[model samples]
Target: MLPTLDARLTAAAELVLPGKPVADIGCDHGKLTAVLAASGKYPRVIGADLRPGPLAKAEQTLEHAGCKDRVELRLGDGLSVLSAGEVGTIVLAGVSAQTTWEIIEQAPWVSQVGGPRLVMVPATRHSELRRWLWEHGFALAADRPVQAAGRWYAVMAAEYTGEVRIPTFTECLFGRTAEWPEGAGYAAWQKAKLPRFRLGVPDGTELAEEIDKLLDGSPSQTR
Candidate 1:
């Protein structure tokens, strides 16, 4: 049996395409990379971060898990540690949207691959991050929230599509597609979130409009 992953790590795992290489940028504990490599979810994984402490921890974890050969722990800024075509999918999690966007901005090759994927979990300023990604030619593939520690957190998966398609404000805020088609499972998944949004949400404004659009599928309010 494998060690359990937290909600954010699980969300990142779901975004990674099977059979492809993956890199976890800012991979703090290296837990996510170790789990993915040990599970055979990907053929290769590079766990990278700017600091060495976390990288060392990740290396130890991967070694203990007997997946050291499959997982590489690198010390550098995002994407700088990996060469061209090193990994098909990249995850930038456990960081602020500002830092994450800066890394994405620096890595131009992100737009070169056929179907390269990016999984992001921004701790703050996510609206700015989404808008920046859309402006930079990424397509919003999947956007949803996961409950963790009595709080709901959003996850976004995007790909380099080389086109500028602005997501509606609602899509940008909550997510871009209500046609989620993941069926009752997803709706049930989202429904569980309604109460929290109702309870803690601030005065009626852009966020509320966007949330409404996410629920009702209205482009006018969302756009």
Candidate 2:
């Protein structure tokens, strides 16, 4: 029997288009790569990792699943190993927003003409990543908050549209949940965390005000 995908990986898989080539960065055990290969939705799947040990593990997992032929395991950091237009979509999950932002900033080719789509799930600070995407010529195509392993995660799918638009404070924090109903839970989750976030920051009053307005059923006023 094949290994099952967790809710998070399932969300990532659903974002990929059929027949498109995909690169799975930080593919720890190659589970996502193997699943993508088996689905026959992607023509090819590249499983990349910075360490050889994880690449070896990915190889083992792929071989065990009899999907070694469909997935090409590569050992490299970030997107350095991939060439321009090598794949039409890239997945970066289980990483911090800061790290994901750095990877995207370094790999400018991913935003060039006919660049690959970006499918990311930041383990923390999702607002930073969303704001960065808007400023970097990418458009948010889809965003969903999925409940996995008793935790909430934000799944963001974006395309390089070469159009720049600054995201408002509300969109940065809650995402465009008003447009994508799937993110309502995520918005509420973020709303609940605002108190804790306010405790640590010196200028937490702004966050408190936002939360207060939200609780009072008023639209968030941009800061």
Candidate 3:
């Protein structure tokens, strides 16, 4: 039996297109990569991590799962080990939005012709990541939340479409998360953050009210 992946990892995998090579960046244990390979959904899954310790752990997990042949383990900085169009899908989870940006920025090949799809789960700064994607010629395809590890995480899928689009204020704040159950929880969670948000940022009070109303059965206020 394949090792079960945590909710966040599972959500990330669901965003990837099947039968394509996948690169799981910062793949801590390779569990998700292994699962992706074992499912026969992808022809190859690359588990890339900067640290040797975690990559080694992933190696053991893949070996035990008997997917070592299908999953390639690499130790290098984000996306540095990958070439243009090497993998049509890439997964970035358990990292900050800034880190995700840094990884992608350092590797411009991802946005080139036939570039890979980005499936990311930022632990924080979902709004920042979303805004970055819009400004960088990538279009947001999916934005949903997953309840995992005693918290909620936003998982997103984007493609390098070469057309830039701006998201509304609410969409940046909470993403399309209001579209589902975990999104409701995500809305509540962001609403709770309003009280502690430092001044000089966007108006938390106004944003909070909007979120509250949205959660109270109002239509999605997206643009």
Candidate 4:
């Protein structure tokens, strides 16, 4: 593992196919990219961000990991610095789901075969992002939640195959509840988060009820 990669990177790494090239967007400190390179998963890892400061820091991280040979740092907004067919996969973490989806929408190169695939962990607007992906062409490849430093986060992987239809408004908000780490633990977890999300989203009225209704409708969970 790269020195700076956290548990989220670890989970994302597990889902990535080995020997592919990857573009790490918003690669703060280049930690995740470094880890992917060191793990010998992606042949080349590109650490990209808009600011020179983060790129500089990422350069240092790659150097520290001695995976610098396999890593390249690019300074640009989203995937702008990368050319078509340059990267095999794209990883965007710690950004809003809206930005994540928008970046994908803007980058025509990503739709190419053997081009950039995307894995994103949006900081917020997750519901919107989920809806966007399904409406577009991507389908959920993996979904798992991890607690890091006392905060729970969902790690989502998606691939754009074709017209991914959205089933309902609730499904968009909750995602594939059939696949939501089915378990009693997850249920308890959601119960705890409801009040918070309710309090957080302005006019979270229908949103909260939908959550409760979704939970009740879900099948039995695991231990």
Question: How many clashes in each structure?
Answer: 1, 0, 0, 3
In model 4, residue pairs whose N, Cα or C atoms come closer than 3 Å (at least 3 residues apart or on different chains), thus clashing, are 19-41, 183-221, 183-222
Which candidate gets the maximum lDDT versus the true structure? Answer: 3
Q: What is candidate 4's CA lDDT for residue 71?
A: 82
RMSD of 1: 4.9
By TM-score, the better pick of 1 and 3 is 3
Q: What is the lDDT of residue 116 in candidate 3?
A: 90
Model 2 CA deviation exceeding 4 Å by range: 178-182, 199-211, 218-223
Show where candidate 4 strays beyond 4 Å. Answer: 112-115, 176-187, 191-212, 215-223
Give candidate 3's TM-score: 0.88
Off by over 4 Å in 1: 113-115, 177-223
Please give, for residues 64-160, the per-residue lDDT of candidate 4 as tens digits.
9889889888888988878887766778899887788788878876765455567778776655787887788777777666666766556778877
Order the candidates by lDDT, highest first: 3, 2, 1, 4
Task: Find the 10 residues in a row with the least total lDDT in model 3.
Answer: 194-203
TM-score of each: 0.78, 0.90, 0.88, 0.81
Predicted candidate 2 versus true structure: per-residue lDDT over 143-193, tens digit per residue: 777889888888889888899988765668866544555566666777787
Question: Model 3, range 140-205, lDDT digits (tens) per residue?
Answer: 778878888788788999889988877765678777787767776777776676445533445457
Model 3 bad stretches (over 4 Å):
202-220
lDDT of each: 0.74, 0.82, 0.83, 0.72
Instruction: Summarize candidate 1's per-residue lDDT along 90-154 as a digit string, tens digits.
Output: 99888888898888878777776475688998877566788888888887787756656665556
